[model samples]
Target: MKTLLSAIILLSSVSAFANCPEFKVPKKFMARESLFSSRATDMTFDAGGNRIAKIEERLLSATTTFDLYDNKRQKIATARQRMFSGGTEIEIKDCAGKIIGKIKERVFHNMFDIYSKYSILDATGKVIAESEKKEILAPSFSVTGTNGKQLMKMRLSTFSTRSLDEWVVEILNDTQADPRILLMIPAFKTSADNRETEK
Candidate 1:
């Protein structure tokens, strides 16, 4: 009876929140950030739990993959993706809810409202690495070293917006860098709609 009661109380505390939990995600582990009000644009976690697939309003699409590492650092499973834009460019993100690192020429305009990428770190806030977006043909990248510490490199072939239908983005391996990965937290936008509410 005591254990059951304790579980009930714990669940009650978790359920008590302004917004319902999303992505079957735990409040403590899930990192939330937003570009506009009323929408949690992104979330990130260090571990994997559930398998999810969703379609958001923006042109943003996703392909999910995972890298399984054993006792020794070995590439087990690699998540690969191919994302494109809608009529106009929107946000592109990873499964963990972070933005792509390098935005292309055409989509650069839309990135103003998005966080490009971030660093995974240790307890002391030292960066483990960082992630950003890239294209395969134009420039391909990966994390090529051991765990805890890794190196990321980006190469851009050329910049052009001639056709306008072009879109390919990848998450840059960002475990070793400065200015640690900025995890976005949902906040209010300085739009005319919210200006009245602020005052």
Candidate 2:
């Protein structure tokens, strides 16, 4: 009985240590902008399907927030972005409001049209991930780890005209990635698109 109990405890500990949840990247996901209000956008697995996350933007406010939820509508993580004169900064926090990561735009790339880069930092401000967007005719973005290994790739499917558009996400190194950060990709891409339109 003692040996069996010890084995069970060991298995539990291993499971806890390997807590990265597996999320299958759908072929295409949809994001819908609010027509009546400029307050929020809903992102789902498919058109009129289960809502996986929401991005809320306040009118005349510098901060934009995103909430990610599981299939059961349980909140997983929340991210907030504050725009400054120089660049935008993002904070990614867990449900308990503990910041897990930070994303800051590379200010030097602001003047260039070829590509834009952002560094993803951990709680201790160490760069754990880096994202870059290629400004081609068909734009695409890729996220890579500190070791320069690609973690995720996202290709724009359809441009947002009036309401809905599609983006296809491919998860490469999921084990090392925070799911909340994956959720924030679409929001970042949307912001980039808006910036291009203004220019």
The candidate scoring highest on TM-score is: 2
Clashes of 1: 18
Please report the TM-score between candidate 1 and the true structure. Answer: 0.22
Candidate 1, residue 83: lDDT: 38
lDDT agreement with native, every candidate: 0.28, 0.65
Give the Cα error of residue 36 in candidate 1, in Å.
Answer: 14
For candidate 1, write residues 1-199 as lDDT tens digits: 9999999998886556222223222222221122322422222223234322212112124432222222133222222223355211112333333443321212222543422333334334443444443433442323222364335433322432322111122223443322112221111111111333445
- Scored by lDDT, model 1 comes in at 0.28
What digit string (tens of lDDT, one per residue) describes model 2 on residues 21-87? 3433443455444422433455554434756555543333656676666665656667787777767
Cα-based TM-score, every candidate:
0.22, 0.69
Poorest lDDT segment (10 consecutive residues) of candidate 2: 20-29
Error of 1 at 1 (Å): 21
